[model samples]
Every structure is written in C-alpha cells, then in structure tokens.
Target chain A: MASGEAILAHGSAAKRPGSPWLSGFVAATISEIKSLYREPAALAFTLGQPIVLLVILVAFDFHTTLPNGKVVPYLDVLVPGLIAFIGMTVGLNGVLFPLSRYKERGILRRVAATPMPTGSFVVAMIVSRLLIALAVTLITWIFGVYVFGADLTGSAVLLIAFATIGSLAFIALGILMVAFARSEDDVAPLMMLVLIPSILFSGAADRQPRPRPHRPRHRYPRPRHLVRRRDHPGRLALQDGVARYE
Target chain B: MATIPAPTRESASHTAQPPALRVANLVKHYKKFEAVRGISFDVQPGEIFGLLGPNGAGKTSTLEIVTGLRDATSGSVEIFGIDIAHHRAEARALLGVQLQESDFFDHLTLKEQLEFLGACYGVKPDTEALLGYVDLADRPNWRLKQLSGGQQQRFALAAALVNDPPLVLLDEPSTGLDPTARRQLWSLIRRLQAGGRTIVLSTHYMEEAEELCDRVAVMDRGVIAGIDTPLALIQQLIDTGFKREVVVRDATLEDVFLHLTGNTLDGVSLDDARKED
Candidate 1:
C-alpha cells in the first residue's frame, strides 16, 4: 500500500510513442483474437464443422455429374462451396454472437470510455474476424487439395480475393444483425434462421437434392453460383482456372 | 467545513484552478422518463466526492453521462477545464472509470487485460505493479471468469487505473466485498488521493461515505436532496431535533470483525507473496 512512488514511476514510464488510434486498433485486434482462441465451442463450430463435413463426404465416396455428363468426385465441387461456407459462417456467427455478448455485457460501453475511437474498435473486430475466417478457409483448401485430390485449379489468389470480399460482406451483415438484435439471447436463433437454409440450399452441403428433370429450378443466385459465375473479373479468373474440373 | 456551499459556476470562476469535475444542470431523458433532473455539483481537485443514493436515484445515469458513455438531454460537464460534450476523447483521457457491472474481454489474462486497456490509451502500464496494487499480482494469468466476485471487482479497479488518469469514477466499488477487502479498498482509495488524484464514487454504504468522503451529495428521485460534508449533514439533523432511540456502541460490527480477523486481505500479504516469487 505504500508503493505510491512505484506506481507513479511506472505510470510516467508507461507512455508509448504513437497515435492512440493506431495502438488502440492493434490492441483491440489482439484482444479479439485472444477471445476467439479461448472459445472452444465457437472455434469447433466454425472451423471444425466444415472439415468434419468434408471428411464425411470423402469417406462416403460421394460423386456428382457435371453438366457435360462427366462423372466427378463431389469433393471437387464441394471444396469451393465449403470454402465459401467457411467465410459465411465465420463472418456471420463469429461476428454476431461475440459482438452481441459484448454489447449485452457493457464491454462496448466500457471501451467507449477510453481514448479509442468507436470506429477503430469496430474495424478492429471486423478485421480480426476476417483473419480467422481466411485462415480457416486456407486450411480447408489445403486439406482438400492434398488429402482428397480435389481439383481447385482455381487461381489461389483469386480464391483468396473472393473469400475476403465474401467474408467482408457477411461481416457487414453480421453487424447489421447485431444492430437489430435485442440481446445476446436473440442472436443464436437469428443466426440459425439465416444459417440453416444457407447450408441446405446454397449448395454448400453434399445431400442437397438436385432439381428433377421436369421441375422448375429456383432463379435466385445461390452462393455456389455466385462464386462460380464468370462475369466479374475475380470470379471470371476463378472460373477460367476451375474450367478443367468442369 | 460546516457551511461550505456546493460550488456553482459563478463561484468556480473565481477560483485560481478549475474544479477537477463540474456538472451544471445535467438532465437525462429516456423517452418518457427523466433519469436525471437538473443536478449540479463540482468536485475540487484531490478530494473524494461521494454520491449517496438509493436504487433508481439516477446515480448510474449521471455517472454514465459524465463518463461520456451516454448522452445527456441537456447539460454540460467539464473535466478539469475541457468540455466533455465537445471534447469527449480528451476528457476521457483524464478519467479512470469503474462501472457498476464490470465486464472485460472474454479470454485475456489479468495482465493482458491491463495491457490492452493501457494500449488503448497509448501507454505501456506496468501490469505487474498494477496487479500487485490490487492484490491480484499472483493471479495475473487468471482470466476474468476464473475470478471470484471480489477478485473481479479488485481487477476492475486495477483496469481503471491503467491509464494513470487524474480523475477516477467508481460506481459502487465495494458493494459485494467482505469487510476486510472493503477496508483494503478504502486504504487504496486514500493512497490514490494522496497521489493527487480526484475520486468520485457512488455507494449505498453510509459508513463508507462517512469514512472516506470529504463531501457527499445525497440524491433521491433524480435530484440531490442535500449536499455537504457527512458530519454537517448529521449536525443539521441533530439541529432539527432528530435523535436515535438506540444507544450508540463504541465500535460497530465491522470493527469487531476486523479486530477478530487480521486486517490483511485474503488471509495473506500479497506483497510478501510477490517478493517470495
């Protein structure tokens, strides 16, 4: 209790030469990464679920017929879809749950009391979540390419660009969901309402029933088609690279 | 000390140095309900000011507004001389706040939490010294969730001081602490004041107010019922012919408890533990 001078000396010695805004960004990003690492359940759900699905598909020896009537292993089609799904889940649930919990627990209000700009805090969160999503996607990609011999002839750089863009979009949507969410309790059900259907019909899953020969196919662009379409420069590059597999 | 009136803007202007904190006609409206109704007070530098109130007395709302966590419907708050509404980031740089319900990042160790907060202020605080100051130096690697309630409260106090701010606001810092821990916190507050830091805290414990506060404002129904030194408030009641029916004891139960149990917190001297380490 008599260490007042020690405290003061440390306080004076603590000054770091930098803009607080930049340091705040770096600190918050590190904090977010630490938080994500510590949550085993969230880590399992986001990263483990996709790899588990991939293993199940490979073990079952699933196959699909392309439009040209050539038979191919389903892993070839599913890997890209799974990579996109990783971005979606990590961007959506990863950002949504923690941000909601933080808001509910008054952590956001507490951080606001500091010199850090609110914008810096939020951007740091988005950036850290993006890093996690991209890292996991890369890991899954490597597994598909090496273990299963999945054809990703897609430009790795283009794949990454698309993944980054797609994850950012989902991250924005997650922020919007957080704004609309009443509490942390509301976030899980809201995420399921979006996640369940996206998993089933977005072509991100193996058992999604193919449209019958006489049935009218849905016109809306599924996530799989969004990545495979050859219009935009990034996706076109990806399509050209992936054309051999098709 | 008996007749020291609450400092107004006019009186404050005459002083050589500005008050550490100044609130003027602060009002906060939450849709249809008014949480704070035009309350004003000034805390001079290096003094402990207490806000004593019952639940729903607008203490938290006023504290939030002063901390720039919430917007006031109408009023102005100045920290040292900087206007809070206009220069909130600068105003915040001078403040160390411990909220009523403290929460932190989920997975960070105690030291990491302090370091992160310090980085937000562009400082590299001596986390070991801060943790030691709070008697949690031995548990620097423990996450917030691993902490007991009293331990978490102490850590919150440490986190608030990471920036070495001039003015510290603690909302009910000792609400759930056992007597020994509470006394330890009181001495820490005194040490902080001795270090030339201003403190503003809210508490339901009248004894806490009497023991530490230089002056206190009793708030009720979103407005201050009275403002003066704790002794002056009691003297005014005695002048009004109010008297206690029960005889006063020489020492209260808190004193008895502290006497029976040694004054050391957590049954061990943390300083000694740190040295042994």
Candidate 2:
C-alpha cells in the first residue's frame, strides 16, 4: 500500500469518536495479544521479563512489611504491585511495540478497510489486555497469599480501578510510540528501551537502595518493590529492585 | 425506453422492495477534496456488478460506503429498501466483504479460522464442507503462514462465503495470484454467481473486468465515466466496428515451461520449501 493511504486509515482508526469503550477496547487488545503470542520471541520478552524481575527482587528483597500495618508475607505485597507492573509492561512493551510493526506491515490498514467498526477494533484491544492482566492478578495473589504469608488492604474496586487507569496510561504510551516509530525493524529495540526505563523508574523491582522519600512526594504512582537491606550482602542494585513492598 | 421484465421477486417479502441496491447522489469529502462525487447507480438481484477504477479513484471508498463500513459524507445507499446511513448493521448484515490485505493468526489452522468466522456469521455449517468448498480440507493442520498466496486468497474467499450472504464484495480478488490460480478463482466465482448470488468487485486490470463482470461501471476521479456491459463499454468507445488479429509465437516460453514443469495449482509439491530450512 502507498504511504498516504495507510496514514489515512491510521488517522481514522485512532480518531473514531464513537468507538465503544468495552468491546472495542477488548477487540483491539485481543488482536494485539493475538499477534504478540504468535511471536515466540516477543512472548519470551513480555512474560519472561516480569517473572525474572520478580525472582531477582525476591532473592535480594529488604522489605518485610506489607502495605497494611499488620506483619504480612512480603509475597502478598509483591503480588498486587506485580499486577500493576505487568500491566504497565504489557501496555508499553507488548501492545505498543507490536502496533508499530503492525502499522509497517499494514495490519491496521487491512483492518481499517473492513466494515468492522473502528470502535469495535479499539474495544477488542483494551479487553484483551484487561483479561490477561486479570488472570495474572488472580494467579499471583492465590499463590502468594496461600503459599507465603501476605496481606492486601486493597478493595476489589480499587484493584480494578488501578488496572484500568494503569492500562490507559500504558495504551497512551503505546500510541505515542506508534506515532513516532520510523520503521517496523525499530519497534523491538525502541520498545525495550522505553519499557526498561519506565519499569526501572517505577521501582518495579527495587532492591538495595534506601529510598529517600521524595522531598515533595511523587504525584505519579510508583510501585516500590524493595528497599535497603539491614544485614544483606546482595548488591545494592538488586536490593533497590526489591524496595516496593518495604 | 423498454422496461425490464418483472418475471419474479421471491423472498420473505415481495412488496416491490427496492432493487437489491440503489445509490443516488453519493458524495464523500475528505475536507475540501471529494473522493466520491455524487455518483449514482443501481444493481438488480443476482447481477455481477463491476466497479472498475485505478488506484485512488474512490472505488474502495464507494464500496466501503455501500457495505456500510464507512458513512458517506452525503447521499444515500439502499440495500433492499434498508437505508445504510440509518441502519448500518441491518444493511451490513446482508453483505460479505473480502479485502485485499487481510491477516489472521499464524498459529491458527485453516479449520479453526473457518469455524471462528462461521460462528461470527451465525451460520454453523459443517466445517469439513466449507473447507472442501475452498479445496483446503486436507491442509487443515497447516498454519496460515504456511500456505501459499493462492491458498490464502482461496481461504479468504471461503471465509467470505461462510454466512452465504446474498451480496459479496471482493476488492481485487486476483491481485497477486498466478495465471492458473487466477483462472481457478474466477471459475469458483462463476460457480457462486450461478448459484444466484450477487457479486460486486473492483479491479484495476481491464481484462479481469471484461472477462468476469456481467456489467461494468468505469470510474475515474471518483465518478462513473461510463456504465455498460464490458463489450458495450469497449464498443461504445468505437465509431466503426473493427476486427482484431491473433498471433502465435513460434515457441512462447510460458508454454514450454509449463509443458516441462506442469501446470496445476494444487501442485505445491513442485515449490514447497522445507520448514526447517
């Protein structure tokens, strides 16, 4: 396809004002996941990165207290943050990166031609990510609370809200990536570059550093996975990665 | 003017329900530029209407509107008396569309894709039967990426027929196929037309429009420059009747190559590459 025609489609799809929120969101998310899961390399990157981070933080973790006042399993606190973290990862890394490639490969153009409402397309995407995020949330909580002692002061409503907003933030980031990406080949590296910094900055796996509380508290939500270890020899880099649950 | 014969109108209703399709003063504007500017036409039941145009000539934009995929900036589209502007879903329920560059999951088998589409169309016919119709029943295990371009196109065509809707819109069905593959596809399309289905197609290739379309709408710059049967369209351009000549080269390469290799579409064994390699 010519570049101008493809650009026209991208504009319309992104600009559909009446796009249905849930179904369109779900369909778009589903298609993104569908394409992502189809690629073994991408799957390894998206799912593997989070699990590997969790394991590294646990080995070097300094945080023993859960978010609640009561003494609780570190795993309990770690699990919920992981939900928000994985969501962030999937949004920026999983959905956005591939969407750039999709634009280059003309997937969006092909879909734009169909009578399928653009609203439906967007809804599908959001739904797919939410579903995957939900599943990951349930599994991690069940395993963490039952297998290890942990506490969650979070209400079901609060948890759901967190995932939705977190998802939107990630989706916005993903669209921005698509807008700026120059070619299909650049998508993978750019996604990794953007995602690594965001995850690291959010303290998804903080370990050794004793976080000096922000002078003016960070208005942005950050997941604190680890903090300074009292008597551990594990490297500070690893400890800072585990500071979120301290 | 001679009126068309009113031999019969058979369906759930016979209340002179408008022609299967009608368009009047259809216009679409992209800001100040008009992609489709007030073109009008009608398609009777069971007619193969071809909209011929070059790329960027608004052929696709018009078809999209007719299929209720996109709303026209101005004018009307009627499908069996249903207004497309007000009843998109109802208008669209009667059409099936095959776009030029469709893609599905690479992991999905041919059977899985057909079954999924069938469920969406709400016509759950036997999966094997549908596969057989597309001539891919034996390759059900093969992934979508594994199939040749011809196989993929045929799979798409079969998927379009899953609902067996009355109207099928094929945008450049033979765009990238080999000659034999193209011929086979045209034959399959003929079979569908013979079964009393209405088909509308867009093509840049003049020969394809000439060979397949029962009637042609020659469009240029988003307007119908002419409309008639292919022969009529071609003939309308001539003031005096003329005859054409044919020549056979001593040994055309295509014949020699085919004679040596063989000419068959299902003969993929001749071109199959090992998956590991």
lDDT of each: 0.79, 0.62
Tens digit of lDDT per residue, candidate 2, span B93-135?
5666787665765645777665444433333435565566567
Number of the top TM-score candidate: 1
Reference-based lDDT, residue B72, model 2: 93
Query: Residue A182 CA error for candidate 2 (Å)?
Result: 9.0
Off by over 4 Å in 1: A1-5, A8-13, A200-246, B1-15, B250-256, B267-277
lDDT of 1 by residue, A116-224 (tens): 8988988998999999999899889877876555767669899899999989999988998999898999998988888889788874455442332222343542233
TM-score of each: 0.86, 0.71
* Candidate 1 clashing pairs, residues 3+ apart or interchain: none
Worst 10 residues of 1 chain A by lDDT: A231-240
Residue A13 of model 2, lDDT score: 14
User: Can you write out model 1's per-residue Cα lDDT over B142-198, one digit (the tens) per residue?
Assistant: 989898776788789889898889899999999988876676677678777766788
The deviation in Å at residue B142 for candidate 1 is 2.2
Residue B132 displacement (Å), model 1: 1.9
